[model samples]
Target chain A: MPAYRPPVIPASEITPRSVYLRRREFMGLMAGAGLALGVGDARAEAPATVPLKTVPGSYKVGEPLTSRDDVTTYNNYYEFGTDKADPSRHSGDFKPRPWTITVDGLVGKPQTFDVDKLIADLPVEERIYRMRCVEAWSMVIPWDGIPLKALLDKVEPQGSAKFVAFETVVRPKEMPGQSGYLQPMPWPYVEGLRLDEAMHPLTILAVGLYGETLPNQNGAPIRLVVPWKYGFKGIKSIVRISLVEKQPPNSWNSLQANEYGFYANVNPGVDHPRWSQATERRIGASGFFGSGRRPTLMFNGYADEVASLYAGMDIRANY
Target chain B: MAMARSPFVDRLTGWGIYVIGFVPAAASFWLGATGGLGADPVRAFEQTLGLWALRFLILTLAITPLRQLAGVNLLRFRRALGLLAFWYAAMHFTVYLTLDRGLIWSTIIPDIARRPFITLGFAALVLLVPLALTSNRLSIRHLGKNWRLLHRLVYVAVSLAGVHYLLATKVLDLTQVVHIGLVVLLLGYRLVRSLIPRPERRAA
Candidate 1:
């Protein structure tokens, strides 16, 4: 594994002098008003208006970002429903506020964090990423959040912790897909990452997108964002984060072991058993009649930074 | 007794079937043009066409079963329904080629050869060709008893289309299961009908 090099991002380089000054003033005002707990309610009600004060993250892809409408509407949140349009339509009743994330399991300092407080305390940044789905569709999104490493650092992983497992909150009353007689998959949807992968600079725990708090359909409170892997690896509406000794089970991998593997890195070389992964339809890239197929990249174009992590291992066999 | 039967009614029903059969394809095209198909319009558009093809194939297969079991004498329109299924299947294939795969022969060829669902769909479409060509009066008159034997391929084609639909879906949800169930029931009816001895025709 590559030695974790601390990114040398001077504070001034991340935010403008005026915005930086205002953020400190804003934080002071926020603390005085006891606003940390109530912030999620206000943000949830009107996300577009109350813009997040964010620094520009190290990674920013130059591609045109997908429209917020499409980003929110076209989702694969099976908790809401199996159809792409089902999430946006059915997630109206989902309550993302009053959320607590439990971080434990092989950690030195196990703790539960109120999601809003965590967002308020940490410095959020905007990182534009190319999200490639396992279904052969791609989108460029500007995600706003802190690096997952920063969150992992808070609890201090134990020596035995080899993997980081995550779980989504199960609220069947709101999430119709979970309440239905025939569920898409076993729920409290679970996902996991290697400890190193979780700590990678590129992995983030996103709270918002497009400079606004995430909409209900888009994993409102918080979600994982690993730009290098297929979109499914970045589990949404995360509730519990556990540092484990053994390789934890992934929801899709558990459902179809032959089709979905633990390491679902975006590789055109490894095709899904049902369909080819050689190319993907770039959402909003082309009109109805035009070809939207774009050749997928190795590790979703993060190969330079991550290729060495799996240098000795056979990717095809692992895939 | 009753008034003389109007010959125009049969002709009108046949024309109506053609018009009604084309609506789904037209509506899908309009949706794609108007941005109603949502993100990944090509996929939505392609799947819609494929779905309509499957629906029409099921409708075509139901005609004989309905007549045999329920005494619904709709056999005259069976040719039009079968032809409609073929046209929709043809359109579905065209869209997949021109839009979905962007007419990439290398990828399309491999998908047809290797992918089980695609191969089954391709075989289904291919089987419909001779049946569609022989649906006319000329071919029927010329071939006599052989025409009926050849037309039995419709059952095979419809069955393949049903299986293709089932395998293409990532998950076997209730909606898909219902569709596949209908196909199985119709095919099973055909099998049961063949085994039982036919009753003698009543003198008209």
Candidate 2:
């Protein structure tokens, strides 16, 4: 391994910045045996050049190059057209303003907050996270958003809250494919997560990427991005957030029942019938070009940190 | 021989069709050029071109029947349309190989080898190459009757194309089923026509 440069916060760079997990909290998280290694250990200081891996310690992060002008310019945003690049041209019709999200269902506080008001109450933190799509492509984006937990706390989930349901705006005129699908999907694309999953520190409510306010095609205004799960799990153009007692019907699951389960925790071993999820292609790598794909990790390698939460549950079946 | 109302009009109409056929390709390119290809622009571009390519391929396939029934023909335009179909199809495959597979030949080789749908598409495109090359009348005259027999591969090529689309989507719905049915109908026409009895010629 390259000289053990410590791993960075890997968290949102929020103003009045987050106190990097208090020593007590870190010690408590590690428990007795794990804490013996010392508290607040952010891995070794990672070298500037390590072969990047989905999980740390697997490879060196050799270069900082993770994006390219060509790839970024040509993207596949399905909201605009079936083609990766159509959205950028056709999405001018999408109106991100006058947008509001209704926080209700099983929350202690139920209220709808408009765009400006929403951000005013919560802060936008710049977070650098790797986003992996189920189609096997990935991009390491510096996304700006609020911690999902922080947003969830604002909603004040009731004791009955077991799940979090999210919905994107659906307008056929703006989103032509809203009804033009060969396959059927519940419009206003829906996605959800268990209460704990929703609150995972890694989960984020993204509003922007690459520092600027989100462009319309990239789920302008607001979207949920769970870096650890397949990209589909990150529903965009969200207009609704509901804390519910039952699992919400997610778009992909409603479309492919068995193929896409309710809990789409990233699993390398379980393959989608049509394709393998074992590997992901990291776009914009150097001479490597598209060769940087590596095996996906369970819980996206956040398992050791979050796996115990699902102890004894067969992940294969869940997957 | 049919007389033209105005040779310039005919020429303009011909140019018009060429421009019309190019519209879809141009629009897709414009999207790409404008940086609107979206999060998966490579896929978006590929799908646009691929879908249009398939539509054009089907249009190319439908030409004979339309001509036979409607007495309408565009033999002069056929070559250009066919070439455009090939160009789009090539772009489709290129997107799959480069953007989709990340240009890893190893991944592409196995996909072609193992996936029958991909195999069919690859084979169909492969068969088109020589037919496309020898489409000229000089080559047709050189090959004699054999030229017609070779060009008949197009019927099978299109069926393969439709099947590739159907299987790749993995959908067995009526949209694709209708496509398959049309292919069957086309082949059926040829089969019945071949079986028809012809008048006997007097001994020379």
Candidate 3:
């Protein structure tokens, strides 16, 4: 079998930003027209009216960013629901405004700050990163965010702190998945990273995507972006940031310890229990059975930047 | 009893079941073509076919119980239902091999060995092959008493299919639990019916 290769689109073929934005506008117009015809409610949420401003980031990837439609529509926010489309549909009513993230536990200065205040304090930059899902699918995303180290420096972690635990808001009314008796996952979806990983320059506290404020489906307001790790490690809609001494329990690890390890680095050698991790289907790249499978890279092709973090640990065991 | 009925109605009923059986496959194709299968259309298509196969297997198993308890004879349509289930199972396996795995034998073989769910599902498909081949009247006439013995493999096939679905899902959601529950009820009814004595009845 041939080694997995990403289809190379010529640089000239890459869609220009203006044209892409125009296409989105045209789609919005079509949807409006459909709505006027007394058809089902068309998605009317306009693209970010105010263009998000970002400085150049050093951690830019060479790969083109996945389309905004794919990034926004195809999400894994279990709070909204498990089905990929459920988040986009159900998260419309979600209130991402007036959000606050509380920084506490094992930090010298524990404080609660408004999300807007947090974004205002730091320099937001655009960082293109490859996001690999545990389900053997991948996407390249352009994220707008401040380096996580900037925020961690403000909190001032104590010497005893070993891991940083992140928690998302638990609002059953806003998140329909949490309201039902049949819970797909435990409430207050939580994730944790080692103190070093949390403080890495590459780690980002994302607030926007595709030159716009983040959509509710794409974890609006504030979310973590640990590019090297599986997408689930980057928890969405973060509410609490706690620096703890012990390894904090995460949602997926708590749910299935064997399947999901704390350090979910994308390693091709370590296969998931149900499926092989060696290859991943690139969403929107091709047809159903077309040439889309690409070889998964170690640490999602960020091994040089992140390999030093796990020098002695066995990846298979950790995985 | 089917012969006593009008030839037109019997032919229509048989053809109707056959046509309706293709709906799941057709719907899956339509969903894929129209982008209705969500973000990962290939995965959605594979799962939809697999679920339908399991559903048809359960429906096929329920036919005997429905006749024994409720006196609703659907034996004439049972062959069509069994063949339909096998067809879906074959399609499910085909999609898994072609679309999902890309026919990577090195990985696929090891996956079957390691993953019990895949093993069970493969076993179910393998068992159905012989039964599907011998579904015609010529095979029944040739095998005589042995035909009933060979077709008994369906019970094992259905059981393996149930376990395959349960293990594959991992999560014990209501739908998975209900599917397994129905299979267990059907198998239990068969066991009880076999134990009790019954008056002689003409075999279909």
Q: DockQ winner among the candidates?
A: 1
Q: Give me the candidate number with maximum lDDT.
A: 1
Ten-residue stretch with the least lDDT total in model 1 chain A: A34-43
Tens-digit lDDT track of model 2 for B10-93? 778767766776666666666655654433445555666665566666667667777777878766567667776777788778
- Measured against the true chain A, the candidates' chain A TM-scores are 0.84, 0.75, 0.85
Give stretches of model 2 more than 4 Å off.
A1-79, A171-184, A283-311, B1-56, B72-106, B113-120, B123-153, B166-204
DockQ of all predictions against the true structure, Cα-based = 0.19, 0.06, 0.13
lDDT (Cα, tens digit) per residue for candidate 3, span B127-188: 99999999999999999999999999999999999888876643444456567788899888
How high is each candidate's TM-score?
0.88, 0.65, 0.86
lDDT of each: 0.81, 0.65, 0.80
* TM-score of candidate 1 relative to the true fold: 0.88
Off by over 4 Å in 3: A1-51, B170-174, B195-204
DockQ score of the complex predicted as candidate 2: 0.06
- Ranking under DockQ, best-scoring first? 1, 3, 2
Q: Rank candidates by TM-score, best first.
A: 1, 3, 2
Residue A98 in candidate 3, Cα distance off native in Å: 0.9
